[model samples]
Target: MARKVTNTRKWIFTCLAWGVALLIFFPILWTILTSFKTEGDAVATPPKFLFFDWTLANYREVQARSDYFSHFMNSVIIALGSTALGLLVAIPAAWAMAFQPGKQTKNVLMWMLSTKMMPAVGVLIPIYILFQRMGLLDSRTGVLIVLMLMNLPIIIWMLYTYFREIPGEILEASRMDGASLWNEIRYVLTPMAVPGIASTMLLNIILAWNEAFWTLNLTTSRAAPLTTFIASYSSPEGLFYAKLSAASTMAIAPILIMGWFSQKQLVRGLTFGAVK
Candidate 1:
């Protein structure tokens, strides 16, 4: 009787889990469906789910209306550029905090994490003014720097956690072998931490790719990424649901493909230190 009850409970939980997963995925599925519909069918009063005349008109119109390639290139540059910069700065910082702790190290880590809690908009005006004065506004270099700094704390925190899992004795042995600080990190430490670093890179790329507020506020035509590309669809005339959905689909497709492919690496990295 107890074994039967356990089986029943497992089945119930499995169904619940699937239900929640479907609920979360419904919006993306709906968006992809809408992207195939005409503008009228997209925003119909009765909310058309699957019963609509699917058309390629929206995709074609969106392509003709916007330089999709340029926006895609901008997104690739910004996301990759910012993530590369973040890793360079964060790796060493994490190494120090992980291996050579001081009295204030914990305090400093907490302080860094605390910054993430602050509302981004609160500092936007100051950052904008600084950017204007420095000629950073609407420049790829400008947005790259901003995105890198914005995501830096998370990068440091994640790398620090991964580094901590590594035994310090390995670095100590490297030191005994006359491995200079740079060589120790470059050769001994980094290779061991590849999985963690890869995961960190993937996550930071996603964060930078999805960042909308800063991109919208800082960039005009010259430096605008996919976020701005999607935003351009909004107008006082009202939403072009089908076209907007198509643009949205295009903007997100690359990252979605990337995330899907790299999910195993991400999971492996996340679980790097979970076991002994």
Candidate 2:
């Protein structure tokens, strides 16, 4: 009877988990479905789920209206560029904090993490002014620097956690072999942490890719990423629901594909130190 009860409970929980997963996934499913409908069908009084006739008009119309390839390339550049810069700065900072501790290290970490809690709006005016004066407004270089700084703390925190899991004794042995700081890190430490670093880079790229507020406020047509590309569909006239959905789907497809492919690496890196 106990074994039967346990099995029944397990089945119940399994069903509940699947239900929640489906519920969360419903929006993306709806968006993809809506993208295939006519504009009228997309926003009909009585919504059509799957009964309506599907069409490819929206995808073609979206491309006709804007340069999808340009926006896609911009997103790729900004996401990758910012992530690369973040990793370059974070790896060394994390190595130092993990290997060499001071009394204020914990305080400094907390301080950096605390900055994430501050709303971007608080500093918007000043940042905007600085960007304007420096000619950074609406430039890819400007946005890249902003994203890199925005994500730096999180990158450092993740790297620090991964570095902590590494045995310090190995580093000591490297030192005994006359491995300089650069060589020790580049050869001994970095190679061992590739999985963690790759996972961190992938996640950061996703975050930067999806960032809408900064991109919208900072960029116009020239330096705009896909976020701005999708926003262009919204005009004084009204929303083009079908075309908007198509553009949204197109904008998100690359990052979604990347995330899907790197799922294993992300899981492994996140669980790097979980077990002994």
Candidate 3:
């Protein structure tokens, strides 16, 4: 009787979980399905869940209307560039804060996080003017720099937490063995913290890839990415549902694929320091 009750409860929880997953995924699934429909079918009064006249017309039209490859390349470059730059700055900063002592370290970290809480639009004017003056507008380098800066604090904080879990004695042992500072970090600290670093980098890449507002405003044609490509479908006239769905599918496909493949490593790394 108890076993039967437990099984029933387990089944109920599983059903609830699937229900929520389907509810959240319905939009994306709908978009993909809509991409295979004609514009007329896409926005039908009784929205077609399935059994619509399927066609590749929307995808073909999306390709004809935009340079899909260019936008994809831009997104790849910006996302990878920003992640690399953030890691470069964040690793050393996290190392120092994690291993070294300072009374103001916690305060400084809190202050850095506070920046993320403030609205991005609040500083838009200043950043925009700065970019204009510096000739960074519509440039890949400019967007890369901005994305790196935006994600830096979070990257540093996550790394700091991971690094803190490592015993200081290992570093001390390295120093006693005549390991130089560079050698200590390169050989000692980094290898053990690989999982945390990997997870942080993956998460940052995803964040940079999906960032729309900053990319939309700071870029036009030259440095425009997939986000910009999707935005281009919108106009004052009205939404092009089928074409928009196609564009969105194309834009999200790469990252979704990447996340699917890397989920194991990401999960392992995220949980690296949690256990003894």
Candidate 4:
């Protein structure tokens, strides 16, 4: 009877979980469906769900209207570049904070995190001017740097959290064995922290890929990413519902596929130290 009761509760929770997942995914699903519809059908009063006539016109038109490939490449470059640069800077910072003793380490960590809470708009003007003066505006290098800096705090914090879970004695043992600082981190600490680092890289890539505000404000055409590609569908005249949906679907498809394939790794990394 106890087993039966537990099974019944388990099934109930499972169904509820599925329901919530579907609810969350419905918007993306709807956008994909709408991408295949005509402009009239996309904004139909009754709102077509699955029973509408499908077409690829929107996708074709989106392609012909703009250089989709260029924006896509821009997104790839900025996302990967920022993540790589962030890891380079963050790994050492996290290692220091994790293994080295400091009077104000915790305070420093908190201060880094507090930067994320401040609104981006608060300092946008200064950053914009700086970028302009430095000739970084609308350049891939500029966007990459901005994204790297923006996500650096999170990367450092995550790496610090994961590093804290590692046994400090192992690092001590390496040092006692005459391993240089570079070799100690490169050979020992990094190998053990692969899962944490992998997850951080994936998360930061997604964040940079989806960043719209800075990208939109800073870029025109030369360095515009997929986010800009999607935004182009909007005009003062009105929204091109079908074309916009098509653009959005194309923009998000790559990331969604990546997340799907890497879900296990992401989950494992997130729960890396939770159990022990």
Candidate 5:
């Protein structure tokens, strides 16, 4: 009877979990479905759900309207560039904070985290002016630099957590073997932390890829990413629902595929220190 009750509970929980998952996924599902509908069907008052006349015209029209490849490449470049630059800075900073001792380290970490609590709009004017002066506005380089800076704190925090899980004795053993600091990090620290590092990189790439506000405000035609590509469907007249949905689906597809493939590694890395 106990075993039967446990199984019943498990089934109930499973159904609830599926329910929540579907609820969360409904919007994306709707967007993809809408992408296949004509504009008239897309915004119908009754909101057609699966019974509408589906078509691929929106996708073709979206392609005809803009250079989807250009925005896609821009997103790829900016996301990758920022993640690489952020990792370069974050790894060492996290390493030092994790392995080395300092009186103000905790305070410093709290201060760094505090920056994220503030609204992006608060600093927008200054950053905009700086980018303008530096010739970065509406440029890929400008957006890349901004994303790197924006995600740097999270990157450092993640790496620091990962680095803390690695035993200090391993690093000590490397030093005793006459390994220099660089060699110790390269050989001893990095290999063991691969999962964490990889997950951090992946998460940051997703964050940068989906970042709409900065991408929208900082870029125009030349440097615009997929977020901007989607926004282009909206105009002073009205929203092009079908075309917008098509653009959104295209913009989100790559990152969605990436997250789907990398979820296991991401979950494993995120839970690295939790178990032991």
Candidate 6:
């Protein structure tokens, strides 16, 4: 009787989980479906779900109206570049904080996290002025720097957590074996913390890729990413529903595919220190 109760509860929970997942995914599904519909069908009063006439006209129009490939490459560069830069700085910082105790380490960590809570708009004017003076506006390098700084705190915190789970004795033993500091981190610490680092990188990449506010405000042509590509479909006249849907679908497809394939690694990294 107890076994039967447990099984019944398990099945109920599983069904609920799937229901929630589908609910969350419905928007994306709608976008994809709308991408294949005509403008009339996309915004019909009754709203056509699947009975609409399917066509690739919107996709073709989106492609012809904007430089999709250029936007795509910009997104790829900014996302990967920012993640790589963040990791470089974060790994060392996390290593030090994890292994070396300082009087104000916890306070400092809290300060860093607090910065994320402040609204981006609060600092926008100052940053914009600085960017204009430095001529970093609408440049890939500029965007990369902003993204790297924006995500740096999270990356460091995550790495610090993962590093804490590692045994200090192992690092001490490496030092005793005459391994240099660089060699110790590169050869010992990094390999052991691969799962954690991988997850951090993936998360940061997604954040950077989806960032719209700064990208939209700062970029006009040169550094415009897929977010910009999607925004182009909106005119002062009105929103082109079918074209906008097509643009959104194209912009998000790559990241969705990447997330799907790397879900296992992401889960493993997130759970790295949970058990032990």
Candidate 6 lDDT over 1-276, as tens digits, reads: 999999999999999999999999999999999999998888898989999889999888877877677888999999999999999999988888889969989888889878877889999999999999999999999989998998888888878887788999999999999999999988998899998888788877887999988899888788998887667655634557888888889889988987886675555444433433
lDDT of 4 by residue, 38-93 (tens): 98899998999988889999989888878777888999999999999999999989
User: lDDT score, residue 228, model 4?
Assistant: 74
Error of 4 at 250 (Å): 1.3
- Candidate 1, after superposition: displacement of residue 98 in Å? 1.5
Query: What's model 5's overall lDDT?
Result: 0.86
- Give per-residue CA lDDT, model 3, range 60-145, as digits (tens): 87778777778889999999999999999989888898999599898988887777778899989999999999999999998999
For all candidates in order, the CA lDDT equals 0.86, 0.85, 0.85, 0.86, 0.86, 0.85
Candidate 2, pairs of clashing residues: none
Using all chains and alpha carbons, the TM-scores for the candidates as numbered come to: 0.83, 0.85, 0.86, 0.83, 0.84, 0.83
| Model 3 TM | 0.86
Report the C-alpha lDDT of model 5 over 105-202, residue by residue, as the tens digit: 98887787777668999999999999899889999999999999988878887787787889999888888899998898788887998877888899
The C-alpha local distance difference test score for the whole of candidate 2 amounts to 0.85
**Poorest 10 consecutive residues by lDDT, candidate 6:** 267-276
Worst 10 residues of 2 by lDDT: 267-276
lDDT of 4: 0.86
Tens-place lDDT per residue, model 2, 1-276, is: 999999999999999999999999999989999999998999898899998989999999877777777888889899999999999998888878989978989888889777876888988889999999999999999999999998888788777777787999999999999999999978998898887787789878988999987899999988999988778766825658888888888888788888897776555444433332
Candidate 3 ranges beyond 4 A from true positions: 44-46, 236-239, 258-276
Question: Which residue pairs collide in model 4, if any?
Answer: none
The reply for model 4, stretches above 4 Å from the true place, is: 1-16, 44-47, 236-239, 260-276
Model 6: CA > 4 A from native: 1-17, 44-46, 51-53, 236-239, 260-276
